[model samples]
Target: GAGVSQSPSNKVTEKGKDVELRCDPISGHTALYWYRQRLGQGLEFLIYFQGNSAPDKSGLPSDRFSAERTGESVSTLTIQRTQQEDSAVYLCASSLSPVQPQHFGDGTRLSIL
Candidate 1:
């Protein structure tokens, strides 16, 4: 697809388990972002990556959440010791630059048991 892509449309894991979500942004995009959307809530920004380096990660809810990108292509969001509250839809987005309009992916639904 020409738009951002996310893997494992649905993921089910037990509480305290670790999970990894993947994202592939549109080619040539230099800015990538990760967001989490819980039931009835808006998208909560998680991290932002310009190229391969993350410049803003203040939106991460806890230390258990971390994300990294490789070059301007794929990125991965890892959650360690996942908890019940961590269940949500993980969304990925990308733009030509930080100031450009973002294109989003079909989010990954995470269900913690």
Candidate 2:
């Protein structure tokens, strides 16, 4: 893709339901990241995948949230048993390297009812 791509720009789910968000990174980007922006809050890093190494999941809020990246091309974020507190804008970004500026997709706005 020319830039980062995310699926289903908006989502609305009942509390306790599960949701999945997808991301497609740029063609040559080696670093992919997932972040969440709660209403009135700043972006919070959720996970990071770099190349073929182990993914960094330290920032994930809980076991309910998980993400996977295949090589460096595409990624998915799954939030299981969602809660009303989980409503937020989930953003995806990709960069060529750790030191480079990341390019972001519009994001999937998750709304838990």
Candidate 3:
């Protein structure tokens, strides 16, 4: 299949609301990752899922952020109590392995109004 895919290419929500973002990784890819990029900043790692292993959530900046991946296919990132600080582009990437390079999708631009 092609590279990772993210839905709702753009999102705008009110503050204190909750939002969910979806990601579909490349077929047969065993490693998937989520990242966030604020305006004028570099991408920040959010979570990583590899095979059946537990996802790495340490990179999630706050308890309001969480992610889950079923197997190696689709992954979702949920943000609770949206804030202006949460406004950014959410990106998804997939790799054949942890050691391999990742291919990223066009990020979902999120705005908190």
Candidate 4:
């Protein structure tokens, strides 16, 4: 029924600040993934969680990025000490797995000021 959704469709923050973005995946989906699409840049995988624990987090750009999911449901991405380079659309998607086509949310557009 319900598709994935992200909060604060747009966010503007100063550099060096901390920001948290939220995502709500479809019901019954067991896998959640986060990705970043920077301006004119290709999509970059951030992290993914299956069930309630994360098994792959290598895509995190640095210590400033972190995320968590609760039992294949809601997820949140947190950025510590935000930087201008981090400004982009943070997208969340969910599916059976990487091989399955994922449904994507409009994403929370973060702009560093």
Candidate 5:
């Protein structure tokens, strides 16, 4: 693939709802990352996956946030009991390795009412 791909580019939900955001990294990429960007704020690293090894999920802000990736392909980020503060852009990026530059996909815009 030419770049990372995210589905349902926009999402709207009420408080307490749960949402799932999906990411498909570029083929052959071995490293994937998830980030959150609140309105007018900088990106915050959320999770990272490298190959089939254990993912680095320490950056997840709460127990409600989780992510999983299989191999070097698709990954899904799930948020439980969504709140107004949870509204933000969820970004996905992929790189050849941990030290390499990453290519990002258009983020999933989440809105909570």
Candidate 6:
């Protein structure tokens, strides 16, 4: 894929179920970011990984939300014990560096029942 690719464009699960969302960023990009956009709200930064540097997870809402990248390639966001309030579109983006423009994926829309 030329751009970021996210799997399972739409997901519907029970409130307590766990979910893992995958993102494959553009090849050669060193910076990757994950964001969550609630209905009618703007994007909320979730996590960021730049090369081998320590990731900045300051935007994570709780311990239930976690993300990791594999050697500047694929990244995955895992949500444990999902809640209804967690419903949103999970966006993934990548860039050459933190200061560069980002290319975003279509996102995975999650709905918790």
Best by TM-score: 6
Clashing pairs in 6: none
Cα lDDT tens digits, model 3, 11-51, are 99999999999999999999999999999999999999999
Mind giving the per-residue lDDT tens digits that candidate 2 earns over 3-113?
788999999999999899999998899999999999999999999999998999999999999998888788999999999999999999999998999999999999999
Which of 5 and 6 is ahead in lDDT?
A: 6
lDDT of 3 at 42: 97
Better of 1 and 4 by lDDT: 1
What number of clashing residue pairs does each candidate have, in the order they appear?
A: 0, 0, 0, 0, 0, 0
lDDT (CA) for every model shown? 0.94, 0.94, 0.94, 0.90, 0.95, 0.97
Prediction 5 TM-score vs. true: 0.97
Q: Candidate 3: which stretches are off by over 4 Å?
A: none
Off by over 4 Å in 2: none
TM-score of each prediction = 0.96, 0.96, 0.97, 0.93, 0.97, 0.98
Give the distance in Å from residue 104's predicted Cα in candidate 6 to where it truly belongs: 0.4
* Worst window of 10 by summed lDDT in candidate 4: 47-56
Q: Candidate 1 on 1-113: residue-level lDDT in tens? A: 58899998999999999999999999999999999999999999999999756459999999999988888889999999999999999999999998999999999999999
Clash pairs for candidate 2: none
**C-alpha lDDT (0 to 100) for residue 32 of candidate 5:** 98
